[model samples]
Target: MTSTAEEEVLIGFGTTCYYLVFRLMITTTGYGLAALGSLIVIRTINLDNAKSWREPKSIQLLCSLIILSCFTGYIILQAAHAFIAIKAGIGGNPVSLAMLLTDDIQLFLNATIILVGDFVICWRAWVLLSEDKFWRYFLALAMIINIGINIADPVYDVPNMKSELKGVFNVLDWLSVACSSIVNLIATSLIAWKAWSHYRLSRETSIWRVGRQSHRARWVLLLIIESGALFLVLQLFALATETGSSFSGSTFDKDLTFVTVAKVAGSLWNVSAALYPLAIIILVHTNNSPIEETYYAGTQHTPVSLTLLGNMRHSASGGGESTAF
Candidate 1:
């Protein structure tokens, strides 16, 4: 290769890296904003009722903390990366400049935050599934492994063959995706299938099951399925990068695109998670009260008593008998 062509290749690589840095900055900022929005939505919802929210308030609060921590950590890491990239572009030593200039460490921290977030998601999924002890152990093991991998990138020194070791670090970084994706896909598929089956049975047999018309469960299932799909796409790209194909660039670009889309989808999931409990609360309160009576106390029993008598008659005549009988 000619001198000019070699320099051009280096320039191109640098430009690509810089472009990715900007993309990461923008994406993480958006995620942080979405996190703030989710926080607001959650606070607005009254999730104090047990029947509406299956998870305890304490657990939900813990998950909210993890979500916020992950958001803040990612944004901080990206901002640090941007600063380092700028310094490096000006002919500074990339490795000696600063902590953020070391992409390996920064990426490891980012991946660590994401993995913790993934485990919280898995915990929520497990709660929804009511699965056995095995799932709990499995998720715990995966979380431990992911944390170990994240620590290894910065803590384990292998300066001799940094390039090859860096690839190994990349593999570790993607392990969360691999493990969580598989688990989520299977669990979500099962949950959706179960919810759908219950809904169908409710319609056919007139049974009143907990999850028969559970929009929350259905949305959780959807979130899991979507998360799994995104993870699979990411896994395929990781494989492409590993195999040393020219198409890896395309895969890398697609991976970034997925990250962007996933951040948006994640925001939606946060809203869904928070809104699910709130919706249940509203629906239950409405069903249990007389709207007209509540609105106008003077006209209370006129509409309220009639509706109550009608419901009782239907219940007695078995017109609206629930199979829970």
Candidate 2:
């Protein structure tokens, strides 16, 4: 039988291997999905009759490209870091290993991706609520708070940082998650409300008209909810992992599960965050079916005035303005 020390070493080695494989798989898969999503978005934009290279849709495409590039950079860095750790051996000091894994570069990239994601979501919220100052101000405030917190996060990344500082770091991380969740939740609610309002107005116009518009409005609402739900779930998972690891102390064996969970959740979060905007763009472009035109056209005959917000800006001819789905 192997000695106790030998068995412990084996366990550590096994854990390290598991981490590397898991990271590699998730990172690669996530990146591939983001790439595919980006391509679809670009293709959809190209096919759009109403949008042009000089339009706001083009700007959104640019933003998506930038976000995806950042995510790619982050994954590359993470892969390198994991390899280095494998070479260093997991038998080293757990605290130092943890600190190395959560290095300055990684934190910076994460904060950057998250900040961009927050901006995209908030921008959408602003466009949707441009007419309503209350929601616009509320979302603006949330974005400001989230951005400030994200910018301040990198400062606490010192080598062998103090326990008090670590506590502060954890607090900042949790605060960011909380603020982001609030922003997403509020933004999604507002968008859904607007879609519901449009649907209601369509129903009053004509049954056949409402049937066409209802399908398109439902799709828009679904996309918004899906995106928001994705972020909220990932953020909650990260928050739980971080909280658990922080309270678990320096025991590597005890903290391994928490750390692993956090890493996986983070990988998925980065990819999903990048893809979120691209997915939105593609969905909006695909939603330009005859149903949309019918819905908008029917609105002209109805006494009710429906204001379509965001990328759905179309000409006011008999057809209602095209809405960004």
Candidate 3:
């Protein structure tokens, strides 16, 4: 009901963007729910397999299920954010919408979960790599930083805090993004390189070939992780442009463009994570019949005659070799 053309135009644009965002959010939420279903199916299969084999553990399958659970929660949170974004179309004010965006406990919880997941990935990578103590310490530091950010977010998010601390927290948040990304990029690259090295070292050995397969699988995982990292950079850039331009009194067109770009980038970032499982599926093959084969090769461990000798020793010792299990 505004009389001004500028007000009408801005409202129109905001409504359009909000609609687009809402659509994407719904799509993302559906995909996440589907992922959760898929994980449930996978978990059932793993549980059945373990039951049949009488095996007590399936670590890989367990990890996948956990990731799926987190992703499911993420999708729900995204849907909530989408609702907030769309609230603007129904005569919601910008500042009110901003407040709504920050008001959700779910948003903060989701962000924290994501941050913790990244830390877990980094720490696990270091443990697998047998990396120096410094890597673990660095991971700890990153986790602490992330926790600090989460704690400070509420305090700094008071009314008009956007005008007060936008620059400071935006920079800090972006820095956190950068730090996590660099850690993953470096760790995954190193893992890929090491895996490739093993592949090159032994070409003809079938059993040792599993090690190479593991390497390939790991390489694929690394690529997915790195793609997510690159997307984070895009997100940070978009955030900077969108929020930064607002404070600078940029043109309406520029503001619209920046916000649209940021929305697209954020959608891509979410979709990228969802697609990681497809990457693993592509990397797997008939040659890599056993799930462990690729991981074995990637681990720099070469199966040898010593395995046979150890088996014989287990039989000779008559204790069923507790180490093997």
Candidate 4:
């Protein structure tokens, strides 16, 4: 079918918006990579100081490095493929099934990134709530379910990329989003609760006579909550955009606006997911202080103590050595 003048104008606008979003994603990806790189360096230094490669902490750092490397590589490759496809005249053209397949691949990569992110957050929750097996099992179950949904999505979506099946795909996609959102919300709440509980316990026991140590612990907790909240807000925005596009599917039959919006939302969501962990690592790094470490040394392990915040050595005298989260 031939395009109307109005439809042509809309397509042009959609294409412009897509490219703008594309540029934004690239910029965000660059920042994310830089942050990840710095984290790797800092972590490596910490590992060297610890002088033990066999420790669980060292293994965790190694795994994190590997995941960040893979995530960065995938983002670059997907961005390049997107640029090439658009240059080959596939931009804003949803009817091009091959281009659509490329998008599906990107979606799969995004799901992988999100899976890694979810695992990281869940792991943090597990450590913070180490004594609570119920919360640990709950978070583990949620992470598993979320990962299952994410893995199932691309498998179901790629094969059924038909106009008639768009709604079905939307349902599957949103199902995954809903699972992830729930997991994030629950985990963040648990972390916040643990932090607050620890603060209250320390106050009641007079374990923290000086307000400075308690203040630092609260700062760490606030940083963690803020980071989680930021990521959740971005995911919610992505979900909103997807819902809007799904609802407007029929009105914009050409699918330009919907396609552009979906791509933008997906890209932003992945970028935010990648940035969240990096932000947490950097925040912990910057907040590390020699004075704080000395003061915290000889401190008993508490539920929401700095030890739970990062990797720290427990002194023989029930204190803590300098650590990074």
Q: Which ten contiguous residues of candidate 3 have the minimum total lDDT?
A: 285-294
Q: Candidate 3's residue-wise lDDT over 140-220, tens digit each?
A: 676676567655654444443445543233444344445545554555555455445434433322224335465776655
Q: What is the alpha-carbon RMSD of candidate 3 to the true structure?
A: 7.9
TM-score of each: 0.56, 0.74, 0.59, 0.70
Cα lDDT for residue 140, candidate 3: 60
| Angstrom error at residue 95, model 1 | 3.6
Estimate the Cα RMSD of every predicted model relative to the unseen true structure: 10.0, 6.4, 7.9, 6.4
Q: What Cα-based lDDT does every candidate model obtain?
A: 0.46, 0.63, 0.48, 0.61
Q: Evaluated with TM-score, which candidate comes out highest?
A: 2
Candidate 1 least-lDDT 10 residues? 288-297
Q: Which stretches of candidate 4 lie over 4 Å from their true place?
A: 1-10, 13-45, 48-55, 90-101, 162-169, 207-227, 248-265, 282-325
Clashing pairs in 2: 296-320, 311-324, 312-322, 312-323, 312-324
Taking the tens digit of each residue's C-alpha lDDT, what string does model 1 give over 222-310? 44343344444444444334333213244543475554454444334332332232222232223321111111112122333244335
Better of 3 and 4 by lDDT: 4
Clash pairs (backbone) in predicted model 4? 297-320, 298-319, 299-319, 310-325
Candidate 3, pairs of clashing residues: 211-297, 213-294, 214-294, 214-295, 215-298
